[model samples]
Target: MLELSPILPIAWLLVSLGFLKMPAYKACLIGLAISGIEAISLWQMDYVLALKATLEGSVFALLPIIWVIVAAFFTYNISLHTGAITHIKQFMSSLSGDRRIQALLIAWGFGGFLEAVAGFGTAVAVPAALLIALGFEPFLAAVVCIFANTAAVAFGVVGIPVNTLAQITELPILPISMAIVWQLAPFGVLVPLLIVVTITKSLKGLQGVWLTTLISGISFGLAQFVVAKYVGPELPAIIGSIFAFLATVLSAKVSPPLRDWKFPREREAAASFAKVQA
Candidate 1:
């Protein structure tokens, strides 16, 4: 019974948050109450020690995690209000008309940069909004952005996640960051290709743009690996994203997509017209 007591708070949290659809804050408070009670009654913990632990955790979360997220959102909102985001959207749109190329640029490259800088939700939200503005289907844009966000999250928000892990594990930051990048490198290389696949809704989407997509992914993965190995966690995502963006642009210049590929409906219409002509 005592061994199972610790699971009660977690089970209540899952039930309240997942099944009952309670607000996160409320569910957390109730879970905290349950934990406090369990610590005091079941574990026979001293009240002062329990209180001290709770206070320390609350302070740590407030100062490091919550404040950082708040600051990131604040910066994003300021950019939005000042029309900087509009200019950025315009700049991205001007880069390429091919939807596949644009997906690589915005979702894979720019989204990774956003994760490096602000993180939390900025990477997914900003890139999805840009894709939607570029005439991508809303659902597809969101999905592609979500897919592209996977690997970059390791070093997200100036590497807070990695730093926090190091602190918790009492490990050196450099080795931890390097190991994380090494593990994530394959995913980093594949996520860009996956984003393209998601955006096009078919493997045929890689028809002509496969080379460019591969270049973007390789550049991103290689840059991240180098930075994480030599520099640290804070700069890997940022440097990797920049390298990916520049490499994609250069590759496109040298060997652009063989044909301008749009969404499924547009491609079908073009195919039908070609068939009629033939």
Candidate 2:
């Protein structure tokens, strides 16, 4: 029972959040209450110490994490109110008519750029919404945005994660950045390919666009690896994102996909989209 005491609070969180469909804030508060009880009783932590730790954590959450998210949403909303979303959508659409390419551009390339600039919640939220505006199903858009965000998150917001890890471990930032790059580089490369698979639901999705995927992945992975190894963490994600975007766009010009891939539903949506434009 003592050994499993810690698990109870976690289990409660999982069940509440996943099964009960509880709102996240409520579920978190309940989990925190359970954790505090366990800590006080089983762990014999002093009440003062527990309270101090919780206070510190709350303060930390309010600063960089919460503030960053707020600023990102504010900026996004400002752009929306200013009618910039339509222009942004048009520019992305002009890049490639194929939804696969568009997904890569917005989710992988643009999301990486946002991650480099803002980190945290901005990357996924902005790009996922952009994809929806571009005609992607909401669920697919969200999933792809998450997939794309993963590649750049290690070095996100100018390598905040690596820097934080370095601070916590008392290790040199460069070495830590290098280690992270080595670990995540392959996944970065595969992320774009995975986005296509997720969007198309078929391996045949890569048939005519293998080169584009390869270029995007290799460009992003190699740039991230090299920058993290040589230039320090702050610039790797930014550089990697730029390189990947350029490589993918130029490759598309040289070797356009032999055929566009679209889900039947998306095709119907496109027909409606055309009518709206006409």
TM-score for candidate 1, residues paired by index: 0.68
Q: How do the residues 1-278 of candidate 2 rate in per-residue lDDT, one tens digit apiece?
A: 89999799889988998899999899989888988898899899999999998889788888866776567567667778999878977887677778899888888988899989887577887787777766788778878988998878877688777788889989998888888888886887689889998888998888888889989989998898888888899998899999999989998888989777777887798899999999
TM-score of each: 0.68, 0.80
Candidate 1 Cα errors over 4 Å, as ranges: 1-94, 267-278
Error (Å) of candidate 2 at residue 188 is 1.7
* Consecutive 10-residue window with the lowest summed lDDT within model 2: 68-77
RMSD (CA, Å), each prediction: 5.9, 3.5
Candidate 1 weakest lDDT stretch, 10 residues: 68-77
Residue 122 displacement in candidate 1 (angstroms): 0.6
lDDT of 1 by residue, 1-278 (tens): 89899899999998998799999899988998999999999899999999998999889878765775566556556767887767766776566668888888988899999989987577777777767766788778878888888988878788888898999999999999888888887897688878877777789889888999999999998998889888898999999999999999888878887777888787888899999999
